[model samples]
Target: MGKPAKNKEVKPKRNRITFETKAKIIKLKDEGKRNSELAKMFGYSTSTIATIYNAKSKAIVQRAVEECVPQGVCVFKTEYRPTVLNDLDTILYEWFKRNEGRKVALTMTALQCKARSIFAILMDPAHGIF
Candidate 1:
């Protein structure tokens, strides 16, 4: 008795449809191209094409198209939100800039100690160190 050999066909790598591609798909749809046609043309699912075509806000579509230049792509509703630590981030950035090119840069432990001290100062009402 002999065991059957398994098929060894290698699968092709799945390609991500980039923001630029999505913008292009929306543009083609605006030009009266059908979802089926777009799916075949862009190698994406019909549902994906339809979603891009039928997005509720025209402003969002326009922004995507405008942002699809050579340098970078624009994503809708994905802007960075400011957190409570924003001030801390700014302080750390300034500290790093000031210490740049120094022979003895701040170690992780020193940075942590500085951050903890700053946090304590911010938290203490008596200090008024906001």
Candidate 2:
């Protein structure tokens, strides 16, 4: 196989249970859907359904689904974001939480800018960011 590009994020596996999918699975479970049913519906495994569903999972799922879980993603990730880009996850989530319930429209460019700012703030040696 050819070497993967250094700059490109690896695409998620076709069946990887993303946070948005987790939210749906959790909702289905709450609505009395069975694990087998969910596994069949989402084309993932039962264990994946079970693992991402739990009492404590609501909080993380909440972060992941903050803004309706856009088609291109917009939040925290356990199984969603690439590990290398998640060094500032906490900061990013905090920003999301801070802006929760507000009608702040986030364009792709805005999100990219935010990510860059967060990266700069976190990686800045002086830590004196404005």
Highest TM-score: give the candidate number: 2
User: TM-score per candidate, in order?
Assistant: 0.35, 0.37
lDDT score, residue 13, model 1?
81
In candidate 2, clashing pairs total 0
The TM-score, computed over Cα atoms with residue i paired to residue i, of candidate 1 is: 0.35
Q: What is the lDDT of residue 49 in candidate 1?
A: 80
Query: Which regions of candidate 1 fall more than 4 Å away from where they truly are?
Result: 1-16, 56-130
Pick out the ten consecutive residues of candidate 2 with the lowest summed lDDT.
70-79
Tens digits of per-residue lDDT for model 2 on 25-130?
8889989999899999988788877877764366475664655654334355554563335667777777776666586876778777888898777655666555
Per-model C-alpha lDDT, please? 0.68, 0.69
Taking all chains together, the TM-score of candidate 2 against the true structure is: 0.37
Candidate 1 RMSD to the correct structure? 12.1
Clashing pairs in 1: none
For model 2, the stretches where C-alpha displacement exceeds 4 angstroms are 1-16, 55-130
Q: lDDT value for candidate 1?
A: 0.68
lDDT of 1 by residue, 24-55 (tens): 88788888999999999988789978877776
Determine the backbone clash count of candidate 1. Answer: 0
